[model samples]
Each structure stands twice: as C-alpha cells, then as structure tokens.
Target: MTHPHRTSDPGVRARFLLAATAWTVLVAAVLVAVPLTFAGRLPDPVASHWGPSGRPDRSMPAAALTLFALVWLVVAGTGLVGLARARGEIRRATRAWFAAGLGWIGGFLIGIQAVTIAANLDRDGWSRAASLSWQVAVVVVGAFVLGALGRLAGRLGPDDAPPERERPGPLIDLDPGRRPVWVSTATAPWAVGLGVVASAAALSFAAAALWGLAPAGWSTALPLALAGVVGLAVSSVSVRIAPEGLTMAFGPLRWPSRTVRLDRIERAWVEWRSPVQVGGWGIRGLPGRATIMIRGGECLVVRYTSGGQLAVSVDDAETGAALLNALAARKTA
Candidate 1:
C-alpha cells in the first residue's frame, strides 16, 4: 500500500502562493509602517545589537536597519516561493508546511523589528535602549502561534490522497555461506559549496569580531556557523547494505548514522524519487516516513514491519534493493 508521488492541484498551489505572498507583504508593510509611525521619536541610530549584559553595544541608522530587515524578509519569502514552484508537483502536507514556514519567518522577523523599534522608541541614544530578554521570548511564542495558524489556513482545501502503487523488489538467490555487501555514496555539490562558503563567512566574521573590527558580529557568526554545519551534514552520505541491515552514515565524520535491522524490514524496493516528492532536499518527511534526497534519481526504499518507510537516494539502487530483499527473506526463513 505504498503511495505514489503526486502533484498538487494548480488552484491549491496558486492559492497557497497568493496567501504566502500576501502574508509576506502584510508583514513587510507592518515592518515599514511601524518605524515610519515613530520616526519622530526614534533615535537617529537605533540599537541593533544587545550584548550578554542586555545592553546595546552596536547601532545602525534606523532607515538602514529597516531596509535591511525588509530585504531579508523579501529574500526569505521569495526563496520559499521559488522552492515550492520548482518542485512542480508537491504533496499537500509539504505545500502547507512550506507556506507555514514562510509565514513564520516573516512574522518572526517582524516581531524582532518591532522589539528593536520599541526598545529604541523615545530614546535619546542607542545606548539607552531597553533590554530584550522578555520581549524576545514573547516574539518567539507569538511567531510560533502565528505559524500554527498559517498551517491551518494553508490546509483549507479538501484532502486528496496520492495514487497507490506498490512495487516489490527482486530477490537474489544466494548460498548460505556467502556474504554480500553493497556500498554507495550520494553527494550534492551545491550543498557542499554552500556549506564551505557559510563556514568561511562564519570564520571571517568571528575573526573580525575578535580583532574588534566588528564587535557585535558574533551574533551573525553564530548562526552562520550553525548553518554551515547543517549544510555540510546533509551534503553527502555513505549508504551501505550488509547482512546486519541497511546503514546510512551522514557527512564525512559518519558519526551520526541510521540503521534498519534486517529483521524489522518487511520489504525493500528501488524507486525513482525526486526532491519535490519528499519536500525538497536533505532529510525530509516525518521520522517514520523519511527521505534522504541528495540528488533526484534511483533510491533504495526500505519498509519496516511497523509500516515506517525510509528512502535514501544512491547509485546502483536496483542491486541494493535486490540484496536487501534477499537478506530479509533469508533472515525470516
């Protein structure tokens, strides 16, 4: 009872696009309007960064800050839209989640801007701005609530199920004394490049901050480093199928890996999977039903007796699937 990949309805996709765009625009408008409304009261240079003591250590022109925030929001929102559009056909759940993400990002950015403006309002100088401890918490919680609402809004249409297409893999006859192993690796060059660039940027930022060139840059550096690590982690993976089960080791270190015990496997198959079918690249879908899509093509799909399915894109998937099926059968026998 496997579900075939399906494309979302045009109307539904368009509606989501419209809703996401509208939400982004609305948040952008608010981001701009709030500053304009208090233009007279805000300091020339608003507090943009607060240090560990909750004091403003860095400042930027109010107008410049507003513009930067606006551009960030626009870029992020547009990226989400572009990703959705590129997928061609997207699952309803995936589409809704993407839309919700757009909404959440916009709202969160807006909230941050709001907090900054509020802190700098009526201040004689950026140094006098209030602390953001409580305000930040409120913004995070509010953004999460808005994101949940956005999810509901995006899921307005009727629920449609994808077509069912079950494919059973071929089994190979092997001697009881023989041991077989299949190994392959999946890599995404784009992800690797992005990871390297982000990591380099983080290092540069940290150096600049350490040298007092940009004392407040630590804030930006931390997130960039995190993103770099995540990008690298998903850039490449080594997949191996052996008598023990199917194992996938992530990144160069191969420290974090997942294994599906041969005994737990109900069946295995080779499927042609696209990033769109599994909600873009990298690790996607829920824990039970997940996909590791480094590139779009043949994937080794393993279904567990508990009904969970995991798909990993790799070369020579046919052989891997065949071997897995044969091993599972032998274990059962």
Candidate 2:
C-alpha cells in the first residue's frame, strides 16, 4: 500500500551520492600519489600491524600495499551503494558517517605508510621518530573527520510522522468481559539462514586448522562468536498486550524488553509491509516508526499521540490489532 505522506526528496539522494563519491576520490588520490612521491625511499616489507602496546607486530611487503588500498576503495564503493538505498533517517545520517569512516581509513593508511617509509629510508626497521607514535596523529585526524561529517549530516533523529493511511473498515471487536491480556510469538526464516552460514564458517575454519593453516587464537574466538550468532538466530520473540500497554521479550532469557502505555496510542490497525518500509526487520526504529518484525506478513500497527508509529509482526495480528483499538478507545473515552 502507498503511504499517504511520504517524502521522496531527490536532493537527499544527491547529497548522499556526492558525499560518497568525493570521499572515494580523495582516498584513491592519497593511495596513488603518496607512494609515487616517495618512490624507492621506503623499505621492501613495512610495518603494517600494531599490537596493544602500540608497537609494530606484523609487516607486509611494500609492493602488496596496493592490495590494501584497493580493498578500502572497494569497501567505500560498496558501502556507498548500500547506504544510499537506505530509507528514512537511516539514509541521511549513516551515509555521511560512513563516508567519514572511509576518509579516516584512508588517512590512517597514508599516515602509517609515510611514517614507515621515512623511518625505513636509512634502515630496515623503524627509526626512533617513525615508531607507533604516528597512531596519535591518525586518531586525532579521524576524530575530526567524524565530527565534520556528523555536523554536515545535521540531526539524525527519525521523522515525527511516517507515511501511513487509515484503514477504511471498522476494527475487530473483542469481548468486553474477557481478560485483557494477549500473547503472541514470532519467528524469522532469515535468522535460520544466518545461523546456517555462521555454523558453516566455524566448521570451515576448524577444518582448515586440522590441516595446520588456521590462526591459533581463531580456534576459540571464532567458535564463541559463531555460537552467539546461532543463539540469537534461533531465539523467538514474545509479545503481550494488556490494559497497561504492550510488552515485548526475546527468548527464554528475555534479556531485552520494552513496554508502551495504552494511553499513548491514538490509532491501531492491521497492516502488511515489506522490509523496505521499516529498514529490513528486527527491532528497527526510525524517527516516527518503530518496527519489531520477525517475518514480513500481517502486523499490528499503532500510531502514538506523539506522532510516532510502532508495529509488531506476528501471528493472529488481526486479534491483536482489534484488542489494541478497543483498549485504546476505552482509555480515550
């Protein structure tokens, strides 16, 4: 369904594209110009990785530095495309911040390379001045870049009123004498897909390690991370609506939960939406809209007195929507 009030500003898209393109060009220039300016003055294999103590711990051949620069360029390009496609406020702020991040990566790479090359001009290792001290400079520059981009993007708050239309039909009716409490659970197939991918990655790493090719610390850290992913994927979302308001919990642990008061709701109805409307599933909120979507089907949508919208995708959503409308109507009366 088409929203009654949706902002489709072409200027916003233009700004996002321009910001990303400019940052990509700047990074490419730094990567190409820096090396050629100081040709033959840098070491063959330069310090590339720094340890917790701010000392060089790993080195990469100077010729291979082009690979690192190319990687960042590709990342910036991909990020720009992804961010440009985002909806609502997420597109506005995240795009600028992401561009700034690309700039920071470029600055750090160029700074470290310059320091390394200068230090290695006279010897194989870093000189007293060319040590990890360059990190301080890069960090400061990165902070400035982030600040500048954030200011450029301005306020990142979600919109106060999302595009929506009132249902022409009457709401569902619930028995006035019955208990007010209603409970529902929802699941997403995408979560299962993510779990499968995580498990496969962990298994692949372990198989490689058996052949003596995997990193040492990865054997433990990778499994732990993968386990966390699987746990989150399989977890079910629980939702309840009562006289007081609506509440949501995740899995048995119910670690993160939320409640909203009935008095704050101005309207309630059933809706069907795609992931694009609420920014692609899973407890996502943007300005005027907050969505708890497990699957993209029937949902209960509520418009708040504060002009914000909240939605939950679940089974028997018609009953939930009806109950919400009846309860909210009673409170308003």
Best by TM-score: 1
The candidate maximizing lDDT is 1
* lDDT (Cα atoms) of all candidates against the true structure: 0.81, 0.66
Error of 2 at 173 (Å): 4.8
lDDT of 1: 0.81
Q: Write the per-residue lDDT of candidate 2 for residues 145-248, one digit (tens) a residue.
A: 75576446533333334335667223555677876788998877667666666767777777677777876646664875677575564455777889888888
TM-score against truth, every candidate: 0.69, 0.58
For candidate 2, the 10 contiguous residues with the lowest summed lDDT are 154-163
Where does model 1 exceed 4 Å of error? 1-10, 29-41, 50-57, 67-71, 78-89, 121-124, 128-138, 162-165, 169-181, 194-231, 242-245, 253-263, 270-288, 293-298, 316-319, 326-333
lDDT of 2 at 226: 70
Tens digits of lDDT, candidate 1, 40-115: 9999889999998888999999897568456757665655545554544445676567767766777788888888
Clashes of 2: 2
CA shift of 192, model 1, Å: 2.9
* Each candidate structure's count of clashing pairs: 0, 2
